[model samples]
Target: MTKITYVTTHGERIDTEAENGATVMETAIMNAVPGIVAECGGACTCATCHVYIDDAWRETVGGPSSMEEDMLDFAFDVKDSSRLSCQIKVRDALDGLVVHVPSRQG
Candidate 1:
């Protein structure tokens, strides 16, 4: 399993483990991590699962796809690190992946 850490807007940390091939959003939902609404259920259709990729993991996580970028335009407080959790797939390489949940979803 890949370990994932979610830092909530209120500064709470939620740790979880997920099997390979699950999306970050799925991990969040499964573990009841707050702030990742996943309104479209990992379809990448909305920005409800918006999160900030930790600066240290930015290179590893990479940039969002053009389609995801289009949707991110609707996200709140978007930054160079902003990403929709649903677009991030879990894998061994991201074992200690950390992401920050925004104060609110778009």
Candidate 2:
């Protein structure tokens, strides 16, 4: 399992373990982590699962794909670090991934 940290807009920091092969959005939904609405489930159709990848892990996490970039246009407060959690798969390399939830969903 990989360890992932999610910082809510309210400043609540939640650390959870995610099974390898699962998407970050899946982990958040499974753990009932607040701030990750995941309205479209794991489909890349909605922007409710928006998150900001921590700067330290940006290189490791990588940027959004062209499709994801298009979807992010509907996300609130999009930033250079913005990403859809559904697009991020859990793996050993991302053991210490950190993501920040925006104050509100788009």
The lDDT of each candidate is 0.95, 0.94
Span of ten consecutive residues with least summed lDDT in model 2: 33-42
Query: How accurate locally is residue 77 in candidate 2, as Cα lDDT from 0 to 100?
Result: 97
Clashing pairs in 2: none
Best by lDDT: 1
Deviation in angstroms for 34 in model 2?
1.0
Query: How well is each residue in 1-106 modelled by candidate 1, as lDDT tens digits?
Result: 8999999989999999988999999999999998889999999899999999999999999999999999999999999999999999998899999999999999
In angstroms, the error of model 1 at 78 is: 0.2
Task: Quantify how close model 2 is to the true structure by its C-alpha RMSD in Å.
Answer: 0.6
User: Over the stretch 1-106, how does candidate 2's per-residue lDDT look in tens digits?
Assistant: 8999999988888999999999999999998888889999879999999999999999999999999999999999999999999999999999999999999987
lDDT of 2: 0.94
